[model samples]
Target: MRADACRNLDTLLQTGAKVLARDPSASITQIAAEAGLDRRTVYRRFATREALLVALFEAKLDEAERVLDEARLTEAPIAVALHRYVEGIVPVSRQWPLDFSSLESPDHVTEKRRQQLRARLSAFVDRGVDEGFFRADVPRTWVRKLLDDLVKLAAHSNPEMEPPKAADLVVEILLRGAGKQ
Candidate 1:
């Protein structure tokens, strides 16, 4: 695809996410208007609302996967990794808050991507346990779940909160609750 085409598609997806986030029932025409593109252009790219949504969902997963990979969750100190993950994921989670379970079709690729992420997080939690950063009594899976929930809570906060602040708050809260007691 041409650079301009890619940029236009990205704009459409970004605008689609924002608009759809506010109104899931928004139509292709609404998305096109919000994206400042001709309705024919959006229709050319996405024949249906479900197609647009699927693209949006895939874009979100791709972004999140990239962020997680960049965090190097298994290569850094567990604490450092956790902070990086929270910081990186907050924006993606906030901007493209699509519920995977609600997608009409269960996407294998997306599910696999999520599983890979979960594996990295699970390993990080186990590493923390070994390093005495996390408690040994609690199951590592429980720690991972707590961390996931904390990150979600932080990302789900009022968009008014700055990303850095949200990240810091989530890390602090997770550490306080899941750290050695």
Candidate 2:
């Protein structure tokens, strides 16, 4: 409710995400210590580890939604928008790295957000088709799938390849396949 309280909650969530990412078995007390907040504060915000995990999941999605908005997926030129989206999403995918088979199921609100994100991305691909950037002969769904996989690949940045370079490579491959032109 208050500014300081909101900040504390955000810190707890952010630190909890990093800590849990590194060690999934991390405890609430550990999260609070890492976040520099009192254990009671974390307990007040989240009654249990599952509750904290659910909050982390929602926080991850919330951040991703913001990144997508910043990408200007619909308004920008397809090439520029694709580049922005890839660059923006790489860190997010790396940080959150959602496990579709996770034990914790997403709540309805999170599921709806996922659907909304997918629809936005699908629309972007359709726009690309309309503008002749992508092959019109290919199904929009296929194109969207291709883009999703490529972005994921880019997100798994290799030690030899920096994230931006990896993202650029993905964009190039998406535009022009591996085969000789």
Candidate 3:
């Protein structure tokens, strides 16, 4: 694409992220209008709400890597690092209502991005096992799958409106299943 077109695309994506961050209900036209473009132009780049959202999700994941780095990886506990997995997931969850689970299988590129994150978690889980933090028998792959399922649940649930008991339910599940034995 031409340099000016590239700039316009970037502007559209930035404007869309801003609009969604503030209000996920913000329409594509609103995003286009905010970016000084037409709805057709916006869809030209994005194709669909899910596509635009996946783009935003990928952007958020990149930001999460920065956050994890800032958290100082080597110094942090394995559980804390594991929490970073959720830390990054929540933004993606917030950006689009069903962000975590709505992820389509065809989106190989983004799926690989998530797999990279899970790989990191797998390594961390292995470390936790060595240090006696996590259970030796708890398979990292299964834990990754479980966390993915849990984030899908957490995406739409209201932990604050609900009792603290609800939030602890998830932690308890993880603890019992992952705690050192």
lDDT of 3 by residue, 44-156 (tens): 88888878778866775676566556544456886565565455555455444334454444377877886776566566656777888767777866765666666656644
Error of 3 at 1 (Å): 15
Best of the two (1, 3) by TM-score: 1
**Candidate 3 runs further than 4 Å off:** 1-37, 44-54, 70-74, 84-88, 96-112, 159-172
Off by over 4 Å in 2: 1-8, 22-40, 100-103, 159-163, 178-181
TM-score per candidate, in order? 0.85, 0.76, 0.58
Which residue pairs show collisions in model 3? none
Tens-digit lDDT track of model 2 for 89-144: 78787777644334265567767877888899989888888888888877888778
Q: Kindly report the root-mean-square deviation of model 2 from the true structure over all alpha carbons.
A: 3.4
lDDT, model 2, position 122: 88
Residue 73, candidate 2: alpha-carbon lDDT: 90
Model 3 alpha-carbon miss at residue 17, Å: 9.1
lDDT of 1 by residue, 1-181 (tens): 9998898999999998888777777888998998999999888988978888888888988888888888887788776777788888888888787666545665677677767766877877888999999889878888888887877787875666777787888878877877898
On TM-score, the stronger of 2 and 3 is 2
Segments in model 1 whose C-alpha atoms lie over 4 Å from true places: none
**Measured by C-alpha RMSD in angstroms, how accurate is candidate 1?**
2.1
lDDT, residue 101, model 2: 32
